[model samples]
Target: MKKIIIGTLSAMILFSGCSNFLKEDPTDFVAPVNYYKTEKEVFSALAGVYDILGNRAAYGRYLFFEMDMSDQCYMALSSTGQDIALYNYDIGDQKLVDTWSILYQGINRANMLLERIDQSDISETLRDNYKGEALFLRAYYYFLLTSNWGSVPLRLQSTKTPGEVDMKPAKLKDIYAQIIVDMTSAADLVGDVTAYKNAGRVSKSTVWGILARVNLKMAGAPLRDKSRYAEAKKWAEKVINLGYHTLNPDYTQVFKNHAQKVYDTKESIWEVEFSYMSGSQYEEGNVGSINGIGTSNKLVGYSYGAQKIMKPYYDSFGVGDLRRDWNINDYYYENEPATGRIVYAGNAAAIFYNRSASKWRREYEITPQKSVNTTTINFPLLRYADVLLMFAEADNMSPEGRSSQAEWCVNQVRQRGFGNLLPGAVPTANVDLPTGLDVVDFQEAIQKERSFELGFEGLRRHDLIRWGIFLQTMQGLKSYKASAAADYQYGFRTAENIKPRDTLFAVPRSEMVVNKLMEQNSGW
Candidate 1:
């Protein structure tokens, strides 16, 4: 159901060192004047926009590894050089440059598709849906841009010529306002979740879930627009009240479905699709292979094992929390003694520095002759669990305080994490939130629970920043690591290098070079 195809459409926009400044000649792209005459062509253009989600600079690798790492996870100590993950990189770092470029490419693609879709002879319903998706995608690209760079050039129109590069940055609040408007409009136009057979396409449920996320960000730091908390609650309520999604009872199975390439449309509301080998090209990703349990042995499924779990995060889980061991690996694959077959080996030697992420295990991939660099495991964008937690946070922050309904939402996620929600399941102790927590206590609980439930899924850094404790949290980790045994010193690198300016990535140097109107973020 998650089919992504980049056809002979030569309208692909190439970047000049991660900047959007390019002079397009007649041969550079298919003239939009003649294209967009058919439904299939419009859909192909939309697919091109979605294609950026899995780009190496975006979700496919760096988003999780470079941007998302924090108190929850850190780059593997085996990594040789200091980079963005350690917060030591500058504006010219190619990772930031590539991430900036690819995100703009997506925006430009969405802009082009939206501009021409009305020219196509598609059905009214289909055209509306396409427009909704384009708007949402453009908002999403801006969301990532604003989330990282603070303020950026707000290019709504397609880049038709080289002169378009001189646009100035929009205010952060203005950018967020535009995001809400576009996503709200998108929510009205997209189809219901049930209308789609897969979680790959944008649906009403997906838009609602992400809108809640967007509002929640606004409600938090830098903006501190507490009014947006109500908006976040409203959007999350729509998704829940729709009765279209539920917590998949098995926490591990949720990710196992991802690794096995099985679509769980109810739980995973939206995902960035990737394929092992499509046509002559390998449209695969590093989801499991880069972040999964590390081993160089091809038989055990090759992974650089580059993502390491911090011990404090591992120990934060209470007893009997099933997600603890599943999210962080306690054992790793190695060549078996007798058969030489790849098998799990207890990680007795694992210190704070060596534990790898375990959510997307490559051993579960069904493809033959597994490639060392990539796997078909899809990266989830919006999951139902996230919506529930967002509802809880917004509800607690609202004037009404934490309602019984809000408490129930948080407990529902915990119940699943503790394996208490399975059919014919035995009641589990310590699976529910303690009775009678004040609003402050409840907010703290939600924060910790988010880390426990959603760790290493590329949300923790944003969560920390929104709570306005990103610096203190990293410093806390640094202190913890510094005081630990000498052997654990290797895990101290990221914490040691983090700085306040790191809250947002420096605007890419490539962009600064061409766009004279571009203003660098403070302290860059």
Candidate 2:
């Protein structure tokens, strides 16, 4: 694979490079005038925008760590404990600061690219594709910002100095409006999924998938705009009707393919690319290291066992659900270093009560360097199964409960989960969708299906928040974890710690200190 080199620009960057610009009264870098003159430069600048997705502060670390805030997983005792505060909704300023800075850095890169793309001599099709990507990425960063911080300053122009650009947070509705416009325009500008040489770049299908998700969030809690349900369903159905994607028959293959860097364009609409060859450890994907099961003594790798599947979520799978075994590892083998022998090791009664989220296993990583903390795994940002589930959800949200299209969309996902089961061979209770279910029941079914289908993919919390059950579900999990017979209560928190204000993370105190125009989220 060709390595993408993310270069520096004349901007108030939060990440590495641009040291000369950072120093007062110092000068060394070329201005944007000299750059962005060629098609190669345009592509390079866009690569920089994509680079942020793999940064440790964004998807590489904090974003996935946010999953700990939900009931799906918990920070293990052996882990760094950086995310433990989030479990109790008591996040510190550093994480918020890093995430906020990195996302804006991405937005700034997109802004810089969008500002300069048209100046290049590239063909109209090429220019529009690049612009579409930049627009989609900008919208994506804004979506993350607004989703986590509620109202965030919308930075459309590139900044030349840190702490100089001050803007107030935009309203959530306004943010969504812009996201809709950008993604809608992106859909028209980009080509089909197959047109892209790789799944790392956004395509027409990718835009539709995200539009569906954005519309769903708009329709749900925090917005509760029922008017957006039809829009949500419409976009989701558009993706489904596109017929450009399908579910991978074996659910485990979806992740295994990612770990091995085997791109399955049919199921994965878009993925954030990561390479160990990037020369920076932080640039390499850390999902497997953090979420993979087994200790150094038990496995050939250096997994931190950071995120453990909570008992309740692990037990939620039905009797014949193949996804349960594929997702949660029941046991591991302890390797005797001296003898070079392996022994079956099951969890002892009270010591280790949690199962590892085995979806992204370190064992499947292609490199022979098992001790490396990072791997060349591409994280799937959007998948066809998610689109199908979103279709079911949005369709059920409408007056008509579980429409024929909705049922078929959902059933396709469920049947895929059964792996090799024949059409009629799947157990009646396992994959069958009951008829004539009410909207409430159908919605509940979709939620459960999503949990089962999308577990440990860094999506459960967002789903819970949008469904308006984040606090309620956390409270219930707390009680359940507390009552369970274990050496340590995993993911249990005191009731007082969780509040409505926690729905949005606290704007980093550092940000509030630097940006005078910024207002902290309520109850922070």
Candidate 3:
């Protein structure tokens, strides 16, 4: 839901060298050392933090869309259908590299602010707010990093040079410990969230929401330390008890017209704000305008003008799943502007048969020009429904896990997709299936519901990886293709590019060369 596919701005944005806060101050720049003087300065520093998360490397584009191609969201790109190679991997595979950079950038910014906050003379209330936010952002960034890389340097200080970060990957145990520390501390410092101006910015519920997710990730497959599930449940419950956010009464609001939900609705816990003026939502620009289109990963759902819905995934929906319609759309209108005319692209008969995404939902207001670049849709990163789902994921995985609570939680989410309304009121998931769902069945159901409820929201790849399902799913998806190029037909991959380990990622050669401390993941 946090991903906006405007068009192809291009591919992942990466930089070899990092930025410096105080290296050179613009004449209008607030000095890094002196910047935290007021609440606004603190807010200004956080502007790009979410942008970092949404980078094309993350959900901004490829990861969410492509991962969907694997499972719930959509079918893989035609190349992805054949290959699952570098193209599908632009985000998922290379994410480990770009994430290393983007997250460290946020962490450094947060650390610098935390290091200098006390001297700012901001009021204690504001001071705590800034510090709490910095801690939360740092923890969130680490969550993004550790989820993928596992063992990464926990750099607490802002290093201006490479020599300063001669740190090696910390144990995953230690990394989670750090996440807990920052999150718990952040929870204590952050009081009521009053910032309604931008729904994407961090607030108290946002902190707890993140804590719930962090703990859920820890409790699940890769780490498999079930003890943390109770902790995850605890954080989720905190967010729930606050009663700040609620499930969207309408499923489509979370995606199509997501901006309308941002500032006005009770559904969003957090969102990354994008605008035609003022702030920049970088991910939207990159994916919307960037590289995916002409390739198999094209924003066009299918060759047919049907708003891009993939075949198998679309078929996966059950009898009365409201989500199917909520998610799939057919593109019909053509825009004739002074810039030119946009003949609707995706619906090209049998050639490309896919439904367009409900979430790629962009600006109805922006007249499409040949160089179309206006989007009003905001990305929802967290929602009330996710909190409930995380609560279920945590409780079900806990040692004292109550089956009823977990069932209730899962049902709350599924009920909506099954066309039941009023949040958790659906009796379908609540009632036991004839054979009755056991732990394994429930766990599998949770994973699928997570995908359905949160498709295109940017969590797919991480969820797949954590479940240890990515490799299996990627390989399974690869087999469905007709081949890389079939007499210039669909489903063909160059044999050299496809492999199981490649499903993970190659350590960016740059980091391997520069930092001996970094070891690559199993496959490149």
What does the lDDT read for residue 209 in candidate 1? 94
Worst 10 residues of 3 by lDDT: 9-18
* CA deviation > 4 Å runs, candidate 1: 1-29, 77-80, 278-281, 336-350, 482-488
- Measured against the true structure, the TM-scores of the candidates, in listed sequence, are 0.92, 0.89, 0.77
Q: Given candidate 3, what's the lDDT at residue 26?
A: 18
Error of 2 at 1 (Å): 35
Q: Write the per-residue lDDT of candidate 2 for residues 308-354, one digit (tens) a residue.
A: 66677766887777888778776564554532323326544343345
Off by over 4 Å in 2: 1-28, 77-92, 161-163, 278-282, 297-299, 336-352, 420-430, 494-496
Model 1 RMSD in angstroms: 5.1
The residue-level lDDT of candidate 1 at 426 comes to 93
Q: Which number leads on TM-score?
A: 1
Report the lDDT tens digits of candidate 3 across residue range 1-524. 01112121111112111111111111243336556566555544544343465555555544445433344433333533432322235423354555466667667767766776787766888788768877888888888776655677787876544466445778888989998999899888875655544455577788888888887777665788777778889888887787666666667655544533346436666765444423333223333332212212122211222124434455566766777655554333333222222334543333233345554443322322212332334556688888888887777666754567677777766666665664565544532222357667777877878767776566866777667777566556545444223432232232224455643444455566666687767655
Query: Cα-based RMSD of the predictions, in order?
Result: 5.1, 5.4, 7.4
Error of 2 at 158 (Å): 1.6
- In Å, residue 439's CA in model 3 sits off its true spot by 1.4
| Clashing residue pair totals per candidate (backbone < 3 A) | 0, 0, 38
Ranking by TM-score: 1, 2, 3
